[model samples]
Target chain A: MSTAYGVAAVVLVVLASALIGGFGIRLSRTTSDFYVASRTVSPLWNASAIGGEYLSAASFLGVAGLILVHGADMLWLPVGWTGGYLVLLVLVSAPLRRSGAYTLPDFAEARLESMLVRRTAGVLVVLIGWLYLMPQFQSAGLVLRAITGAPEGVGGLLVAAVVAVNVLSGGMRSITFVQAFQYWLKLTALAVPLVFLLLAWRADGTPGPGAGAATWALPLAGGREYGLYSTYSLILATFLGTMGLPHVLVRFYTNPDGRAARRTTLAVLALLGAFYLMPAVYGTLGRIYLPGLRGGDMVVLTLPARLVGGVAGDLLTALVTAGAFAAFLSTSSGLTVSVAGVIGQDILRGGVRSFQAAAVVAVVVPLGLASLTRPLPVADVVGLAFAVAASSFCPLLVLGIWWRRLTSAGATAGLLTGGGLACGAVLLTLVGGPHTGLAGALLAQPAAWSVPVAFVVMIVVSLLTPGRIPPGVARIMVRLHTPETLDLDRGDWRPRSS
Target chain B: MATRHDDASVYERIEADDRFRELRRRFRSWVFPMTAAFLAWYLLYVALSGWARDLMAVKVLGNVNVALVLGLLQFVSTFLIAWAYSRYAARRLDPLAGEIRAEAEHEAERERA
Candidate 1:
């Protein structure tokens, strides 16, 4: 009986996404429309799409489950995740949009004025996309195993198929509307039960923070030394890393102006903040309810069932399942769009034919990797992606925009230094058992080290190769400075001919 | 961020525009050192946690190990750097951008002849 509901929920979510994509296909006309919705998406719609993709299975389920297991320390994951956007808003959103790059590679090329730098940036974007997508695929399999008692491979395969179809058919244009709608759908499906659960918890004698919950009350273990270090590292990575993310950075270009870019980021922050709070609540409650379960990690799926077992339990589980499916699909589609864009532009011609083929290559490679291997904890896997991003593209984006002295040689050096180190750490993680705290965290979460390494490498290399800095830097700056109405490529990007 | 000068010139147009020179002077004022200091704080955490594992004892809170303090600091530092970067950008970088923008506009108007 529960299996039937789970099956029904999955079908509904897939149908919903397809329905949205089908409608989007009718509206998709130009390549710009396909890639960035002609840079005219409203903030509200864009906000919804951002929320949809941002609230991955990790956000919807893993963070909460982690909180249930680890206490307040885990809270930092959601806090840092949401705060990453706030950083994006304050530092990058508008200027990046003004830069007129579709992918991170575009930003790197224009910023550093070198194809080598652009290619380096392009490769790193794929690595980050692939690293990030692996977890989504893993979780999809995990969720399937939990719901249908099916093998782990089934859900990952199913999701890849669904995500590939949607992305290939509609591109970014259709994916935008579909993801926007999924964000709300996921929120409502999760939120409604949460209110009921809070009431139910209150009625069930309103238990205290639970038995082992006392340890969570202590903020830092000792003085603020460790706290200071960890927080700063995470901050540096998230704040710097946002502009380099092909998926997130691509969104900024959709806005029409700097002001619109700023406003869209603000809306995203609010939407993300609201959604983030819900997961922590689920995590906190999971502790009180499902403490004895194996893999305290899967508690998000277990909570609704434990709280309202029987028909209601089945229904709530189905709703959560559907939301989880939405998370996987939305994020995967966004990643596919970004990765395919990079593959098409850098490696292939980005023709319609190439775009379609690139989409398949982009999705297939990661799905194979995910099927062959089990990833680390969801948070850890995601953090590694951030670390690689920090090392490679983060330096390029930050220095490219702000520092005038940066050369393409510098960018290439930084990308290799940061991305190479990060990839090495990821390999260590795959091969080795857990290291110590900072080492484990660094290995597990290498962003803090990789970002600085990248930055330092860029600065050092640029100093040595000062002569290679591009001659057109001034003119490019003028173009970047020009307002959208005066943009030379406004009509060009929106070319009517295929 | 440089101009295109003729080939006979020995140097590229690395001239620091008035605002930029000022911006550079001001950037080194507090921020460069400050970011370096914060960067140090982060590295210390990694060093202490990984290499100096014996430097501190492990305590338990709920199920979170004591090392979480270091982990959480990573998040806190992210906010601090973000705030710091934004503050620096608004104070130093924006003025330079505005001045350059105004100068560009003025130059364009003069060129209408």
Candidate 2:
């Protein structure tokens, strides 16, 4: 638990990130490279980068912490998160890549032929980006506070500053390399410590995580009221939400083609499945070892030192600390790039300079929000962001890709209705103070009700306003559904130079 | 050469083509059923975890219960589905889509030339 190892780990990760980012900038010379790496990334590298960016603090630290506290029920969080990519792969991956859109708003405009829907989607992208980014910042602070006992704000600021610098320097291309490297680093950090911890437990005669506590080991039996409803809502939010995340969806744009996109997603599913297997191990081990540990988030960091007290334990702790920091940096960098891309394309004049400026805005606003608000448990807050996304963009993407009858008016109404309801529910839960019973559970987990309502509203509205279907719907559908191997005038939806 | 006006009509013609319809149908038929099946499987797992606590808690191994087994199975099923879909896409969806795309592009090129 020495401060020196933790500080060194933080410094090392930052230096490595900066170095990789610098390498990316040198490779990137054109505007396309700045946005989507000129769509040349191979599936393995793209999948690693996606895995790196996708496994945020929620996966690294929060999953273990929640599992440690909530028992088997919390396993759903990681399962739902990984299964989300299955849904993404089966439904959205190829067609979305084939859509030739740089951002979600571009997809909207291309599909609906309406700037209004595009602008609305642009706004939702920024909002969701902020919602997702706030937790990374907050958890960065929490993890730093646990490691070096630094002020909470300092860690968030350090992460924000580093992410902003990385994004502004290399954009997506550099961030890709940085994230891919971080994925391996994170896996080593957790997996290595785990081997030693398990050995130590075996040496100590292999005690279980309090086998006598019946409810603790049982799924949904921990006296959690409305457990059924909450679990279903969590499933809906995560399963459908992966396609809607601004950061996650934007990574697909880096694939060389629709086939590569699908291949990359398949790789992501495998990579993520492998990584997720370790966190639950840490959590279950924590139950027996760190019984008195109150701050559940600190379980991963504290376990190595508690179980193996020596220089080696200190080194292991430092390694996990480095991984935690990597989680914050890689996820924040991805979110910043996606958010800045939207802002640069929509709000500011289109150029790399605007993207740089937008990156600064993207990081600063979330840092400010993290400072102003009370930090919720990292995974819970992230779940709210997923709920909002599942309700909004999931519907839009699914309908936009498959259904030719989808009208602009339908999209706009659905985006507003679904995004608004989910966002309103999230805001109420965050700000309106805790209310127990049905209302609280419903507000806390809005995806079950919100997602279905969003889909129905979209379908009904599109049917009612049949005449509002864009005249170019057929052409757009052809562009989207067709493989990129086809030589057709898929209308250019690239970021326009302003 | 096909004019800009003709390009729109060409896309519409391609959209209405039997090959295009087959390509779309192939993708939808495979993906829709798979999506529904996996989603239903996942939800059933979630529902079982939520409502059937005693069932999930029944120990199948040393300190490993049905809940843990089912949870791990979700991971297995996800990987399985991903693998299956990629194979299906490569064999069934991608090849037919490629053929249709090639034909459409060839038709468009003949009109242009």
Give the CA lDDT, 0 to 100, for residue A206 in model 2: 93
Chain A TM-scores, per candidate, are 0.94, 0.97
What is the alpha-carbon lDDT for the whole of candidate 2? 0.88
Second chain TM-score for model 1: 0.66
Q: Give the per-residue lDDT of model 1 (tens digit) for A1-498.
A: 389999899999999999989888877766787688887888888888988887787788778876776665566566667666754665455456666667777777777668888788888889889988888989988888888999998898899999989887888889988999999988987897787688878788766566545454333333223554555566566656666667887887777665466556666766776777777778778878777665455776777777777898788888889998999999999989989888877798766667778898988898988976655567667766776877787677667767778888888998999999989988788657346666766676677778877899999999999898888676555444343233233111221234
Model 2, residue A92: displacement in angstroms? 1.4
True contacts kept of 1: 0.01
Highest lDDT model number: 2
Stretches of model 2 off by over 4 angstroms after superposition: A432-434, B1-3
